[model samples]
Target: MSTPTGFMEYKRQLPVDRDPIERVKDWEEFHKLLSEDELRTQGARCMDCGTPYCHTGIDMTGGTSGCPVHNLIPEWNNLVYRGLWREALERLHKTNNFPEFTGRICPAPCEGSCTVGLIDQPVTIKSIEQAIVDKGFEEGWIVPTPPEKRTGKRVAVVGSGPAGLAAAAQLNKAGHSVTVFERSDRIGGLLMYGIPSMKLDKKIVQRRVDLLAAEGVEFVTNTEIGKDIPAKQLVDEYDAVVLCGGATKPREFNIEGSNLKGVHYAMDFLTGTIKSLLDSNLEDGNYISAKDKHVIVIGGGDTGSDCVATSLRHGCRSVTQFGTHQKAPLTRDPINNPWPQFPNVYTLDYAQEEAKAIFGEDPREFSIMTTKFVGDDEGNLKELHTVQIQRKVDENGRKSYEPIPGTERVFKADMALIAIGFDGPEQTLAQQLGLETDRRSNVKAKYGQYRTNVDKVFAAGDMRRGQSLVVWAINEGREAAREVDKYLMGSTVLV
Candidate 1:
């Protein structure tokens, strides 16, 4: 701890945001960079707890927590505090393959479980972590460290999402020959298309993917197992197989008129737009654009928020979001979601704030559930029928819902986006492999082990655990790689 004396003296400081009102008008990251001096002060604020929960990456139940990738938080915090920037980055990279992605998009449970947060503000962990990774990129300290040796073992990673990439990175480091297969024309899966460039620039993903390629990771685009390439062929050619195809089965609404022309899945709109933007040959004109249209988004999750933001960019006449649950309190509710756990609370994201600033009110309508989609005779969605509902716990402690009286109403909607969530991984690959799946159709693999019933067939990320954050995918990838390595060598040193 280089600045222990300044621990209590220095307060937590996060990077300042650009003026929200102005920043929302464009597709760019709102958070500004903190100077080296500012970052040093923030790092110095870390109490660096004797029992640091931030880096444990495990919960009270002895399972994963805080950070899924299990980053060495204290070591990096200390390294940053001491101004040993390069060493600090090395420590950060020891566990995390892509701090840059997690740095920007991760919800940062590590901060929630932070020891300093018990009384005072958390030790600016997320901010400092972001600074460290970005600094490494800026200083060119981050490089392609290709393996000096290659193990003869061959591996095929299905799906080029975060998990597949992370697993490939680690396994390749261990000298195993690795190749990633992606059905999409371009690689990076969700990162390349699903996520908007405003939140995460696709070029940033491409940069990292390029570096991984230089380090000897082979990426095969437009190739999908059970389709373009047979599942049996991969199993025959490789010693091990990793499934990171991701949970692509979108959750559907049971409401009427869901099949209307103007109604679309959140991924369809977001992914379509990004693909067109990135690929000149691809035409996004076919995408569902809300320009001059009234937009209604179902669900209050990140995907719904993305819908709202994208609609605004498309120059929608008006935008509104419907959440089937009550609005959460702005402040943390320890009684509901306690400390050392992911605190449950309401937070204003960029999309909500953007809609609020533009529409003169928050776009969200909590406790409002869409009953049906009203559509024109031409099969185009025109409006949404919804009602407010109340939730109550039954005698069995199971909560249920009921619509409130006099709450039925109609909202104008030229376009509707369903963003409830994903259900499971698509069926093609799973069925082809004849792999066992849980009730949700997610590949059946215990969280830590990430091994499927089929020997040498491993699964990780959303494909195994259902939809989740990118950080968790990275964790699943690393852990699965460890298990795969062990299976091949009779023992492994991946962790």
Candidate 2:
């Protein structure tokens, strides 16, 4: 342990975020970094328990318990505490391919499972992680170190998201030639467009892409497999193919008047705004506008919150988010939600924080479900019908949302954004390659093996495992690369 009583002596602290109201006016990252002395003190707060659960990386009760990437949390914390920052960055790179991304956006399940969290707050792990990598970059310690030799093996990676990028990076490190194919006009699939800029700046995504390119990983954008190029052609040409094209099909909210003019999927709205911002700083006026309009975002989680923030940035007259679940209590329920499992509690995320700062209250409506879209004669959305719901369990142990009588309500809305979630990946490529898929429409592949039914083909990340965090995607990608390397060389040195 760095210090015997460090945990007791130093209470957990995180850098204060930029003023939410001021940050909403521009599209930039809102987080600030703590000074070196403060960061070292925060790192010292790690208990470094003999039985640390922070890096266990297990699932419990349908939620993650620890870091999915299995980060060496304790070791890095000690290193940072000792002022060995470069060493801390090196240890961080051992597992995570993109700490900068995860440190910024990941939910930090690791903190929930921390030994210290059983008593006080957990170590500032996520912030320390970001600081380590960011410091590495600023000090010029991170650079492109291409393989000393090439193995003469060629690998094709589908999708340029977290999984695909990590797979490509690992495969290239093993001296394999990697070509990443992305359908979008740029690399970093979800990282580039799906998320808003305020959350993850695009430059961070591009910097990593440039490093991968320098390390001899080729990236091909604007070309989709199974469409612009034949999926079979890749299977035939490359030594091996790894699919990481993520679960992209947004779940449909089919209700009365669902096809109204002002109703759209959450991804569509987010993607358009980002693309426009990157292309011309919104000067082209090619994206959705919520200005001077009352907007309603259906569903909750990060996407719904992002919609709320984006609408606020557009100067929306008012915004409200509808969530299917009840309002979470301020603290975890010990009996139902035990210590190790991620705490299901009420906390304002960045977007909601911005909304509250601007509107004087959080704009989330819990335990509500939208019923139908009330539209005008021109089929333009005007409002949405909703009813409060309560959770009920039947004799069979199946759960259902039961509507409560006399709780029906309607809210005026000029635009409605569906941000529920995704179904699975689009099936065109899988169908074209004659690959099997699970019932969920994810590519059929064993979790550890990542091998599809087809020979020399593998799937990883959300495409194989369904929608999940970026850390899990990186984990699957790294593992899948190892399997691919073994398949190609009849042996493997990758981990």
Which has the greatest TM-score? 2
State each model's C-alpha RMSD to the native.
Answer: 2.1, 0.8
**lDDT (CA) for every model shown?**
0.85, 0.94
lDDT of 2 by residue, 238-343 (tens): 9999999999999988999899999999999999999999999999999999999899999888999999999999999999999998899998898999899999
Clashes of each: 1, 0
lDDT of 2 at 479: 96
All candidates: TM-score? 0.95, 0.99
- Residue-wise lDDT of candidate 1 within 329-437, one digit each (tens)? 8877766666787666687787898888888898999998888998888988888898899998898988888999998999998998999999999988778878999
**Model 2: lDDT of residue 333:** 91
Q: Model 1 reaches what TM-score against the true structure?
A: 0.95
Residue 173 lDDT (model 2): 97
Candidate number achieving the greatest lDDT relative to the actual structure: 2
- Give model 2 RMSD, 1 decimal: 0.8
